[model samples]
Target: MFFILLSLFIARVTAEAAAGGEESALLRLSDVPAAQAFIDSSEVTVIGFFETDESRGYKEFLAAVKQIESLSVAVCSEEEVWTKYNITSDTISIFRKADVHQKHLQLSETKKVDSDGLVRFFTINDIHYITEYNQASAVGLFQSEVKTHLLLMSNRDMSDFNQLKERLRALAPKYTGKMLFVLVNGNARVLEYFKLRSRDLPRIAIYDADSDRKWLMPKGEISAERVQNFCDSYLSGDLQKQNEAETSEDKTEL
Candidate 1:
């Protein structure tokens, strides 16, 4: 089983790096106590085991992890780490948020794994894992000059938003550099300050830096078709948008 899992991970490593980067986010470790502390402090961890850094999975998993936040990756090239973890061979182990619950994934030894799969694995139990935005970073997100954004405002459970991810991920590469898709928690002070209503539990909205306009997707619909069509319409200049008005009711239902 371990050998199969290792082989599967090695296969994923051979695939091309995704759009973002080749940088690795591995945190170097020297002791078991420190590793335990790291596990306790972090919500998730991905540790790659190898006798040396030369393993292909070591380089590949490290690079794949950089695209994700909150996931700590470390290369256990040292024999002490191997003995401590009881790993006799190469593998990528995913440690859940808790201190002890963890299991290695076979991750489809036959299928190719991409950045999407790695991110999905981090949030596998609930696929709608969205980034929470607060007052501090709100400006950078909503007003960035470099790219427009498709932002969803929601704090609902993963089940509510998970399905839309596939469509969003597909649209991402098609519109690369032009738009970034983000999810902001409903509890953000900035969102609360906007006086957004509870009826807006899950809202699809876009921020256009070019026109300084905010476009809201039609209400109560969050399907992939809605997302793709909305983006296509907006980018093609067919969708009408409005500014963030003073009144609670905006031009769009959302």
Candidate 2:
């Protein structure tokens, strides 16, 4: 009887060990403490979080997180976890330690990491401009004088909007492998000059081979220029630094 009991006990222990090994291979953000402990005991640690459909501005965030090789992720709702962490907005927060509170602080100023780290959102409204083109007129003269006068008379309404959009489209691919999201804050009456309705705005806009998802404001309030400035700042890499810290703890683990 004693010999039979010993054999059964050994079998159970082996099975438990194998299960534990599999569990250790995958890590989640909510399991931060265990993950940190693992990092302390192991050579490296990686964790991943999924952006949900409920998050208003996080459509592009999911793709950005997937680019990190160390992270293992899945599709799931972030509402409960985000509320627990007091994160009201759609964003990704990465850290080297287990303390969630400290990690939140570090994420506030995180920088874009190559093409994977670029995230953007916008709000545009109230763009009204008028212009006319004459096919019989000289192409160069018509462009220079006639177009210039119409734009000037419109009080900067149509000044450089198209040029800026083209420039952003050209640079989009260099920052993010995918196109960034463009949100219209409200007031699309300005687009009436082109006979475009708020809802009829391009669902997908392309520039220089890059394509971005576009959304229009249902109510229209902010100006298009303000929206452009906001986008420029988000893509400028001024707000945050990539993970470049070399702490003694990190070095010792290596």
Q: Each model's C-alpha lDDT? A: 0.56, 0.31
Tens-digit lDDT string for candidate 2 (151-196):
1111124444455444433433332312232222223443453345
Compared with the true structure, the alpha-carbon lDDT of candidate 1 equals 0.56
Lowest summed lDDT window (length 10), candidate 2: 121-130
- Off-target runs (Cα >4 Å) in candidate 2 are 1-51, 54-57, 72-80, 98-115, 118-254
Candidate 1 per-residue C-alpha lDDT over 1-254 given as tens digits, one digit per residue, 9 for 90 to 100: 45444443443343223223443324545555545554554445666665666653555565567666555565555577667777666666666432134546443341555555555555442111133355544543443333477877776565766556555655555554456666666665536644577556677887766765677777867877788788888777777622224233654556
Q: Which candidate is the best by TM-score?
A: 1
- lDDT, candidate 2, equals 0.31
